[model samples]
Target: MNVETETMKNEAAPEIRIGGGVPVLGPRDTPVAEVVHACHSASIDQGLAALAIPGLNRETLEPVLQYCAGLRCVADNVSCPGCKRRTEAQGIETLDQFILSKKEVIVGDGRVRLKGEGTETVTTPCLETLSKQWSGENYWFWARRVIRKLRHGLRRAHMRGEPVAGEGETPSIILMEPQLADNIGMVARACANFGLDDLRLVSPRDGWPNEKARIAASGANYIIDDARAYGTLEESIADLNWVGATTARQRDLRKPVLTPEQAIVEMRKRISRGERCGVLFGRERNGLETSEVAVADAFIMIPVNSRFASLNLAQAVLLTGYEWMRSDAGRSLGRVTTYEKPLTEGLYLGRDRPATKEELLGLFEHLERELETNGFFNPAHRRSTVSQNLRTLLTRLNATEQEVRTLRGIVATLSQGKGRARKREE
Candidate 1:
């Protein structure tokens, strides 16, 4: 069988042949969802050119490109087969060869036009429809991320272990009906930030194990990898003995309302007695319904300006995690590594002690002597008062031993003028 016949036999749907025998995944009228799936499953070597559905130009390609693992010409620079062969013949294996040899395609104002080649132009769908379909989703930026991952591998691929919070140490963070995958990724990062280990999701709108969430997670792969998604809120919190729902709006429920600090404290107390505790966060658009809030043992209300009480999904989780870690006995002020020690609340004096009384007195005398030589006291009657004022000023510095020595050196240098003054005296 020929390549076309073999290709058609293998494909689930009829292939639309383009660019002289290159197999397009579907017909010209293929839906956006199928196009996206085809692009994701397409081999990196074949690229977007092979999956040429109608209206699959740069403007409409972002949503498809983000899901793709490897598409060699996903950038503004479009690579042709001839250029690839030429570069390969010259033994150029780097990405620069492909980038340098490709033609530039300009995408803007609902049009995709090739600049360097024959100037092929394709008009895209209306902006309003695009916006409604993918609100706040930047597919082009996401495409770059996909290209980056294809080149460098997944972010923090080597990091894998138990959660930052040890077994049963921190409370499980539960997100209810999170709409955006990016928000979920950010929540994972926040969980990693303050040692909150477990992350549970109930009916995420974008579905679980999404690449967008993984990309947004930034480097909290461990949290994203282990995050559990349940069908319902009840199933998510089924394992926990006590759960607290976070809300900014006032609810008429009789459940006790506590601040983040108080909730963390209460959870800690319950966990000490071997109870599994969790914190429930609401959806991004609208918070938990009264019934959902009612299911929780207590409702947590973070202190905020009454006018603007709503917080971002990740922000709520971050605040709760911060409170959980704030009172930890082993917690450091910041990151403590091998060469950097844990800091406390005080003045940091490294390798130097406070100035001794003798050192301080010597500084005072030296300063006073210099002032006397310079006639800074003005009247002789005011000499005692001026000297007393100068002593007080110097004493208030609370200088270290090294600081005292440096001040004395500065005074000597100013008063005597070093080598020149000695030569003039001689």
Candidate 2:
């Protein structure tokens, strides 16, 4: 089996040389979706050029190539053959591992250079930019999700009648330079889970209209479809009446630090007065920068352990969204479907009423008669005390009418005989 697989991998390379030497990524007659899938799968197992997909050209493959390259390098860092070979040889899968394996060269302008083997050098973005972009994402997993989207349409695409928030009803969730499309999708899901409708992205890392984001959204396709991406943070929040930037690190800025609950309250007040409100979340790698935070009217801080205050992008959005919907009058404890009614806090007694006092008395009398017949109260002197104790225990049950009937039936069956026992006695 191993030999056959190796032969197939070797044979797959030559099939790319067809139709005037244009590289095809899959076999002839392959569906476009299958070709895309093969391209991504081959990009992981082999290189991007491994597959020979028919009808796949540079123009058609540009998006996949860009996505693959973005996943391999950090923040527009150039991919080098030497670095690729070294990473493949050493089985280095993570960005941190790739960074550590190479020698860092600090240039005169404070820019970092990654020196790979044999004169191959790659220039990287600033440390802060690198930190913001490199999220330790699984490239292959992302590829599979993209492939899934190509094969099947967005999740819950057929479902309809999702509640839409009205104007000023909820705050717009603004994500500033989120690195992972998956994180953005999860943030959309979080937004949908609450009542927040508007989603704005400022300089998303992988670019907008990403299938990965749609796939990551699970069933919240509406949010993903409606999400707007902007080139700058200013452009993203220009229409908002007020904006709060969420962060864990304390900034020296004099802006008010409001908790998530307090921020939601302020937003609700502003929105009630016909003002648009928004919440700004920073990148997944590092939270918002000081300059970015300065743009917001206030700082929204969630209470957490001081030592470990950093949260995932979706988590921060989810927490803020929860607070926004916490006091909603129309909100149910959980989902309310056609068959399932909304529930409140208390014991649920479905289709059953509490036992009446007369029913309780009848049960007590029946149980006492059974006990007396079975000689359960052995000592005649203490019969009254034992009977009182039994009555107290039975009264405390607070059983329903159905429960009382079940108890009586149990007592009768045990005192007499049931099924096989009755047959044996006969």
Which lDDT value does model 1 have at 300?
Answer: 97
- Which stretches in model 2 have alpha-carbon errors above 4 Å? 1-14, 17-54, 57-111, 114-123, 126-147, 231-235, 238-242, 253-256, 269-274, 295-297, 375-398, 419-426
Off by over 4 Å in 1: 1-131, 134-139, 351-353, 378-388, 420-426
**Residue-wise lDDT of candidate 1 within 1-426, one digit each (tens)?**
898645544544333233332223345534223344433333222334666443444344554454322333333223223223234444556533323333543335636533433223323244333224322233234346545555566677666645755677789999999988889989998998898879999999878877667767888888888899999998998889999999988888889989999999999999999999999999998989989998999999999999999999999999999998897878777777899999876778877899999999999988888888999888989999988888898889889999998998777778888775456435
The alpha-carbon deviation from the true structure for residue 263 of candidate 2, after best TM-score superposition, in angstroms, is 3.3
* True-structure RMSD, every candidate: 11.9, 9.4
Backbone clash pairs for candidate 1 read none
Estimate the lDDT of model 1.
0.71
User: Please, what are the lDDT tens digits per residue for candidate 2 over residues 1-426?
Assistant: 697545544552212222321222354533223334444433322323444443344334545544443443333332223233235545676666656655553333655465543333344456665553333334434455544444554567665335467856789999999998889889988998897889999999888877667657778888887889999999999889999999999899999999999998898889889999999999887788999999999999999999899999999999998988886767777787999988776767788999999999999898888898888888878889988998899889888999998998787779887774355435
How many clashes show up per model? 0, 6
TM-score of 2: 0.68
lDDT for 195 (candidate 2) = 74
